[model samples]
Target: MLSTKSFKGVNVFMSRNLVPPEVFDALLDALKLNGADVFLCCDPSRHGHNDFHIISSPDHEKFEDLKAKGCNLLGPHCVLSCAKEHRSLPKQGFTCCLAMDGIKVLASGFDMDEKVKIEQMVTAMGGVLQTKASVDVRFVIVKNVSAAKYKWALNVLKKPIVTINWLYQCWNEHRVVPQESYRVLPFSGLTICVTRIPADKRKEIEKIIIQNGGKYSAELTKKCDKYKVARRWGHIHIVTRKWFDHMS
Candidate 1:
């Protein structure tokens, strides 16, 4: 069938390293549903003993089809990384970096298979793997932070280091996700609250609160973590001077 989904003339790439066949097919299907032209090929560097290329037919034209072909023309910058920033979204615009070079990714771990799996995940999800560390590296994914490379990322280069959870989360969510959720910080967690501090004090005090590991909320909902009240708004609690004194 002729695809109704508009790739806007974009192509996607897949990596063939430690990846399951089912996952590969699913990835292409998902992309096709969202109107993305897709490919099931891998970085040419990865051709050793595994399947890196999908035997595509020139007559075929469907996103989900395993035999997806690559054409002479790809959209723009070969942007394979899925991110909320700029034109990363499929519909707005895509770069198909996966087909070209993929995202500049560095994987660190003890298990070679695991490392390969990570590579597969990245390429399937639209990322490129760099063989080594460099200024061009955009993200360093680590399952073993104890590795020397992880420390280099931490101390020497001061690179943006992310855990393997970041990758799985993105795959599960099927979208580019903010790294904040994968991190744990002293005051990083968000806690929405309906606060009753006066407008002037609210901003100032909330700044202090946020700095000290708290969050704010505008709506009074069940999902709200805390509530401050000038009057009894249902079962909400009112903070007294004692509470302020305690906070101080």
Candidate 2:
């Protein structure tokens, strides 16, 4: 049986459209029994940053707006599941937004215990875990960028190689967070060209770029043209040496 205070600190707002009246009443009872603070309407002024909004549909008009406001939107089943388990279940499995569904993941440079946990969480979140780097692997979770699997995933497979913390954040948040902040190679997907620097200094820069998941070119190419078009469209940035130094 669930403890009376299983959800002591949880604050939830259930949309009237989320479930039938009878089901909603039962859920309300369950939430109350489990010591959750439940709200019938979503009033921005009344809710705090930690409050969850139980949504009826992902395509609801206010979905994007609520998400932008950092609201935790979840399906109705998430609540029932938590009540059943007597604990807070990961929202990824119960929500319609299966963040890692169909994503193939490979783990590298982690010990046995960590790998086991990663596999369990990835599988639970509807992702496939691969023991080796392969064509189908879309993401590589790495502790060390110098790991052989990391090199193969980044260089040969051209897959996104991210730090282990990325996986943990996704598991904790029950969604796949942005990769830019968690990438093992922050310079991934960039083509860097250095000019006006000495040859020795240029070599050092090139090494840094490659090590950080970037490509270096001696001369401009069609790739640069594509990036130029991207820049003109405001899709890409052309930063100065000062910015580069700050980032480095």
For all candidates, the clash counts are 5, 0
lDDT of 2: 0.70
Which residues of candidate 2, in runs, are more than 4 Å off?
1-97, 186-248
Q: Report the poorest 10 consecutive residues by lDDT, candidate 1.
A: 71-80
Q: Quote the RMSD, in angstroms, for model 1.
A: 15.8
Instruction: Give the winner by lDDT.
Output: 2
Q: For residues 123-221, what per-residue lDDT tens digits would candidate 2 score against the true structure?
A: 755678898768998898887654658668766898778888898788767688888788886565567766557787888888888877778877554
Candidate 1, residues 110-216, lDDT tens digits: the string is 47888877776666556677778887777777654445477677667665677678877765554556776553222233343435457776666567556544565
lDDT of each: 0.49, 0.70
Error of 2 at 163 (Å): 0.5
Estimate TM-scores for all models. 0.37, 0.41
Count: clashes, candidate 2: 0
